[model samples]
Target chain A: MTTRVLVAKVGLDGHDRGIKVVARILRDAGMEVVYTGLFQTPEMVAVAAIQEDVDVVGLSMLSGAHLTLAPLVVAALRERGSDIPVVVGGIVPGNDVEDLTAAGVAAIFGPGASAEEIVTAITTLVPQGH
Target chain B: MTDNPYKTWREAFDAAPTRDADFTTLSGIPLEPVYGPEEGEFPGAYPYTRGIHASMYRSKLWTMRMFAGFGTAVDTNARFREIIAAGGTGLSTAFDMPTLLGLDSDDPMSLGEVGRCGVAIDSLADVRDLFAGIDLSRITTSMTINSPAAVMLALFVAQAEERGVKRSALGGTLQNDILKEYQAQKEFVFPPRQSMRLVRDTMAFTAAEMPKWNSISVSGYHIREAGSTAAEELAFTLANGFAYVELAREAGLTIDDVAPRLSFFFNAHIDFFEEIAKYRAARRVWATWTRGHYGAEDPRSWQLRFHTQTAGVSLTAQQPEVNIARTAIEALAGVLGGTQSLHTNSMDEAIALPTARAARIALRTQQVLAYETNVAHVADPLGGSWFVEELTSEVERQAEEILAEILDKGRGSMLEGCIAGIEENWFQGRIADSAYALEKTFNAGRRIVVGVNAFTEGNEEEDLAILRITNADEKKQVERLAAVRQARHAARVEAALATLKRQAADPTINLMPALIDAAKAEATVGEMMGAMVTVFGRHVEVPSL
Candidate 1:
């Protein structure tokens, strides 16, 4: 069994350092990783996820647009009837992590999160062989 | 009574080298148990493992270049004056996305983006307005622009000439590094090879005329901020720089002629000492390579002068105020590491473009360090410090290895290979692995960042107003852009663009003169870019693993 994660950078946040890093780590860890490049609209992110048929949708947001951008991606995924677990990482404030989680983000990794921990979280959330 | 305390300490320290090893690098470079002269020789020498100059900051203070740009030319001009009055010795211009991408404000694609991130300069008129009272002859300026950098530079030259300032007298830099734009920053107009051509042309032009001006600021700021590690940033940036030198030489210019004017821009990230070591290692590596590999004779050409901006990614949207502290530390690292110019991130940067007050505070932070602190009193104050020297050597080694890997892929035509590596998430993979590992440490209570995972705090409202660029400004910009298009002679514009397209097709003809001619005929950025697109074609990034 394999865990598939779609790592997408939504909106105008050109900062992909985190997302790219996570994608590489997941791929190396034997999880399939799909990376959608910069300026990905929410619709684009969801469509890519569905097309790729990934188990987790990881959104990396650095532009303060996360408040507006992250939720839109989650909502778009839901509207598409996709229940794939979602995770987000970037300069997300601690207080907003819970709000993001409540908005259907399964987990949130802020600055300083380890790739292993994120990989572990994704595995736990959608356990391999489940 | 004498239980051999040293032996006991060694036993405890060596208990678990694998799990409990206390290391001091993002890549986990092990710390030496101790350091002697044998570890690293000294400062002001080969490998420059300590400091480049014998007396570093003590001899000259780092240039306080506050990055300023906002709204229209008039608005940005005001900000520039305010910053200079408040002790900014150098000027750094930040153009709006449209300007950066070579679109006039009135273009359809530039509707809402003009003057939002930076200033909007549609023509030489706006450029004149931008530097209205400023003395270009006396003070230096750095333009944070790429893509259509050649046009912007031509406007700058024409504007200076209009004010009776000679091109030779112009002392500044243009972020003419278009390669990095394709690599990290998305604001690119022409394809990679053509962009390199423009850079070479500009280098050729500047080498002949504006000798004091830096033709290219090979930037790793965007790359590092985009998620590269300190070593990746240093290595990739130097590789890009070497590629440019090779390109310039291919264009019939000698290495020594252009190397001196070449500069760099780095992102001073949150890792305090790591950032410092990166800078130190950069200088040594650049000096060694230019002198040894490129056969650069000029000492100035060997020196790696750079500008730095505090890592924008390090700032948090949650506890916005905490960003101030982070910026301060980053700025300190940059200053200590010997940056020629520095821009501290505004506290509210994580939210939006900085307001007037926030920009002031950011400038004042540099001022406080310059005048108020004793950090500037000594040159390379940390020079020969056992830890700093070791870290510097480690970074240099790592960076050199990365550069070798890049060079081995292909030196001159590595753009495709580089992009392929990126698509395969090679660089991104390394950065993510390090970033995640660091985060894991913090989460596991092994590492701690104040006001983050370890520090729980109540909700606190920010006292400052986050400046937002309104849609009305965008509308005005569009209207202004439209008016300019309406006023300019359509026939002349079309003729100039056709001429530009013709010149662009020929490799021998320098594109700068034609680009300037196009700009003079009121050719909008989009039109010029469109013409080039017809000739050069758009770059379709290759999809990889």
Candidate 2:
């Protein structure tokens, strides 16, 4: 099965180099990837995730707005009654990791995360039934 | 063993196996094992391949201009004071996203984003607060803003006037480069033609009125950050600069008139020798093109002055302390390459806005490089090296090819051609391809990043203190913006914006005067930009299929 993932950048952060790199990495891994480009609102990301029926959501944020923005994506998913596992990456402070996980994020990938680690985490975190 | 004296050493050297890897640079320039004397004469001469100045750092050290701004204007002002106290020579301002996009801190779209990435400057009030105690006459201030750069420059000029300083006496660089915004940074607002008009207005205004200020700093920093090769960065930045010169000429100024004030900004990535070569090549290419192609007569017009920032993209959030070494090396490359000024990225920048302590350490890296390392004693110390010469010429040749391609795309004008390229997504496509290729190589384990691919460390966050901006900061900024709106007379702002809109519609009239009037009237960034948006529609990039 081709693992479907939606790589998203939410809020007003214009740094897209990291997110673009992640999208290409996922695509190279033989996964179906849809990128919801820069300045995407939570509503936009959630709608895209549902429409694409992605198995995992990889959110890339660097403006220290992950705590505010990441939870919105998770909550929007909950509002839609979707169980797509969300993985957050990019400059997530270590102290906030446990909180984000507690808030229903499946995994957190920081600056030095390898492609294998990221791909493996995404593959394992997604439910087999999906 | 053989009887010959060198037989054993030669045999041993041949027996040892070397790693089978490509010896080319990121731009695909081939490298040799050693370098000796070759082409190119002494530094500080015509066609300045080695450097633009004779003394280089020996006579005057490069300006240590640290890019620091976050939270509200007052907060950033305090940071500026701290930077000056800690021995920084100049200041570079980084505006927040909303401000960069020409939106007020109180705009609905600016919620939760106020003062997050950089300082939020809504009106002249914020700009005034930004430089409260700093003497504008004494220190050079470089602002990193595009799209709404004219508006920001107007605000800065207004601040200087308010402090009883002559506009002619004010000195600094305004990153009025909009072409790069369209191509890489993605901070563009109005359509291309309209945006260039704004850029034209600033160039003409500064060249005539503010002779001491650099009207624009043509930047390749963002292009490199967007994953361009060194050659691409050089070629794209120089091409954009050529377009600006052409635009100024069309606007009725001679090339020499505007060209002298023109400057450049580049990214110093971790590739030490290659980075140095890139800068050297950049100067040679710019000098040749401006002199031969543009017919620039003034020596200053032919010289390429640039500022180099240590690559922010190269920093790693994991084992972030090691980034100090990375910055030091990159800064050294910038110095050796003869940068007029430099900014060293803090180790923690990859994670969050640089903490005050982290920023100080970053500044000190430059201090050590400038004062301690005697490498700055000579200009282009590697000028005659065979390897560096090959790399420099190759970089210049590749950049020339790209420039020719861009010029051909424009028909006759590089400016027209670049606008065409932007519309056709030529620049974006090339950058995307380069970025994707680099990322693929990193993923395939062909390239090993110390903390990333190899010697992987788990979380070392326990010891690090990342700068945290709270929600309270956003609330406070919005409140400040609200108060400014209340205090200013609404009629004055409305009248000034009307004049601005009227001038925006009439392309012949310069918008700086009208914009400065708006700034004086206390018009917010969003309001003034909104008025212009009425005449010149906003730009919404059509994503590639």
TM-score of chain B of each: 0.87, 0.92
Give each prediction's DockQ, rounded to 2 decimals: 0.16, 0.45
Model 2 stretches with alpha carbons more than 4 Å out: B1-40, B457-461
lDDT of 2 at A93: 78
Provide the global lDDT of candidate 2 against the true structure: 0.87
Consecutive 10-residue window with the lowest summed lDDT within model 1 chain B: B16-25
Stretches of candidate 1 off by over 4 Å are A1-13, A18-34, A39-130, B1-55, B106-108, B411-429, B432-445, B543-545
Q: Model 1, chain A: how large is the TM-score?
A: 0.94
**Each candidate: what lDDT?**
0.76, 0.87
How high is each candidate's TM-score? 0.80, 0.92
For candidate 2, write residues B1-545 as lDDT tens digits.
55442343234334544434444544666654222233325455568776776545544788999999999999999999999999999999998888888888777667767888899999999999999989777789999999899999999999899888889998999999999987888888899999999999999999889999999999999999988999999999999999999999879999999988999999999999999999999999999999999899998988999999999989987788989999999999999899999999998988789989999999999998876656665568787788988999999889999999999999878999889999998888788889888877887789988888787766444547888887899999988988998999999899999999988999999999999999999999999899999999988776541
